[model samples]
Target: MKDKLARNISIYRKEQGLTQEELAKLLGISFQAVSKWENAQTMPDITLLPALSTILEVSVDKLLGYVAQDKRITIYEDEYQTEDYYWGTEPNTACYQVLQLIPPTKPLKLLDIGCGEGKDAVFFARNGYEVDAFDVTNAGIEKTRRLADRTGVHVNVFKADLLEFRLDTHYDIIFSSGVLHYMKPEYRADIFDNYKRFTNENGMHVFNVFVNKPFIAPPPEKETNAYPWQSGQLLTYYHDWLIRDSAEIVFDCNSSGIPHQHAMTTMVAQKITTSP
Candidate 1:
């Protein structure tokens, strides 16, 4: 456990481009103390874990190296077999809004993370963008491929888990509609960092997440499928980017014909720098 924590701390600190002295200054500790922690010679005081995690842009669980036993791949496989458009067939409204905000240029290269049925990916491909879409389940990928064929549009659809997927190419537009929030909280920072890293300069990212709300009841205790963001939490991850559009709204959940109110945070931001 100590080794894992030390390794994670070192990796995250370097990812943020902070030296021991710099991280120590942020933590109000001495450089030697930071070095010791990274060296596995000592641990940070328990009380400092929260502040340390906040500065490193990770959750405390991640700092301590908690691994999520994710069941999304299996759950999604079952869901896709029963409902083709479990989330909906129409592209999200935010996707259209983001298209309008894109600068006038040649057709862009786009990637859709967690693209279930390829509706949005096909929509973009039909409009002339080179699109690549991925989902974790084979059923989802199969559905997306069929949708692309039915629409007479070409889309590269594959099954890949977001946590382990690597990008061979950068994209001018990265769209993830309602998918990211399903990640475990401890893993979100790394996922967001990857999004920024694989986005081309001046490219845009459009996504949405469920946010914690007093009015919305929590999912069942045994359900680990969704992780809701704290209010205003999503924007904090994009501090180095230029926010083009954002909204917090409460809406009806019509995707599965399930009638329920959901509080969500939607954002469209442009990459201004290579790092965030």
Candidate 2:
């Protein structure tokens, strides 16, 4: 564990172009302590694991260097491939509940960020919303376009990275599911800040994330050295935005045959208004 933690720390620190002293300062610990940890002479305490994970961009389990012996469930690769994961599944049922939250109004401008396979986008268009979806995969974009044509619904799907793409218009509802969770904690705040920028004053922002906590007794093993609260493709955290309009907890009592702990959550925040 000590050797693995040291290796992970050194690798990430090098990638970030940070020296040991710089890393120590960020962690607010002594240079000697950082050196000791990197040299395998000492280990970080458990209470400090989350902070260390945030600073190092690695998971707590990875910090301890314990690998999962069991196979993990693959969530989805991109928008198109996600169809199999949601169709006829309990997760899809939960997704329907979210879709129902959109008010029944014609020409409601909608931005489906990280729209996988255009399922939600197509659904929105069929239900009378002007849907524009964006995803990073070429395959997903083509497939979504084909689906829209076949269904006789007009959806503008773009094959581009949402992070780099600029939205030219404001939307009534800007929504994402299973997207924010995948972002590293270090970048999650920045992503939300950008969302706030793109949203209109009256627009609503809705998204899902894994809340911090483990599910069931004898918890599952970590998949990646990503973060303490999130595993591979699964992100869990509460909304940190200041102007939240509403929030809710939709527990997944039965998801994928495994008892999930703090696995399902939804939050809505509105762009705040100020006097002119």
Whose lDDT is greatest here?
1
Locate the minimum summed-lDDT window of 10 residues in model 1: 67-76
Stretches off by above 4 angstroms in model 1 are 1-74, 219-223, 274-276
lDDT per residue, candidate 2, 135-185, as tens digits?
665556666676778778998887544333445467877777765544555
Model 1: per-residue Cα lDDT over 1-276, one tens digit each: 777687778767876889899999999999999999987899999999999999998888867867432345435677788654766577778767866888336978899988977778888888778899988777788888887888899999877666545465799998888677667666678668877898899999898887889988653333456656877888988999999888999887644445567788898889986555
lDDT of 2: 0.59
For model 2, the superposed segments whose C-alpha errors exceed 4 Å read: 1-75, 78-107, 162-169, 217-262
User: Going through the candidates in order, what is the number of backbone clashes in each?
Assistant: 0, 7
**What's the CA error at residue 109 for candidate 2, in Å?**
2.2
Q: TM-scores, in order shown?
A: 0.70, 0.55
> Which clashing pairs does model 1 show?
none
Candidate 2, run of 10 with poorest lDDT:
67-76
